[model samples]
Target: MTSDNKDRLGSKLHDVEAAREDQWARQRDADLLEKMRERMSKTACPHCKQFLVAKSEAGVPLHVCPAGHGAWIDAPALKAVLKEQK
Candidate 1:
């Protein structure tokens, strides 16, 4: 192949690789979030032993104890909530 054609092929390959990596990362994040949701749904409040209720405030997702025991915010959600407060 000519030099220009070879360079174009290399660039296209790089773009394809980057797209694949992005897709993989998105899928991995989705899987992790799904697992977290499943675990959270099954979790009971430490103090009340009642199933925690899914909730959101300031667009931050969290789990609140049905018995008014307390709330649970994952690290990412806590960070988002705190950021929004400021």
Candidate 2:
């Protein structure tokens, strides 16, 4: 094949590869977003109106807003965490 034709073919191949990578990245991002949404709490934070993310600190389970609005911990759990701090 002529050098010019080979260069064009190589450019096309590069474009194809870039398109595939872009598609894979978009799919990956979508999957990650879905998983994150699934893990989020059904309840909304009263302070921020955002969904909460469940977490454990010092073995105490609590729901925290992703916006850093505030965390929801039951009275007993709060006592446990505070007691442990002392």
Model 2 misplaced regions, further than 4 Å: 41-86
Best by lDDT: 1
lDDT of 2 at 58: 73
**Across residues 1-86, which tens digit of lDDT does each residue of candidate 2 receive?**
99999999999999999999999999997896566546557779988788888787777767898999888876777898889889
Residues 1-86, model 1: lDDT tens digits: 89999999999999999999999999998898787778898999888798888887666778889889998989987787778789
Clashes of each: 0, 0
With a 3 Å backbone cut-off (N, CA, C), the pairs that clash in candidate 2 are: none
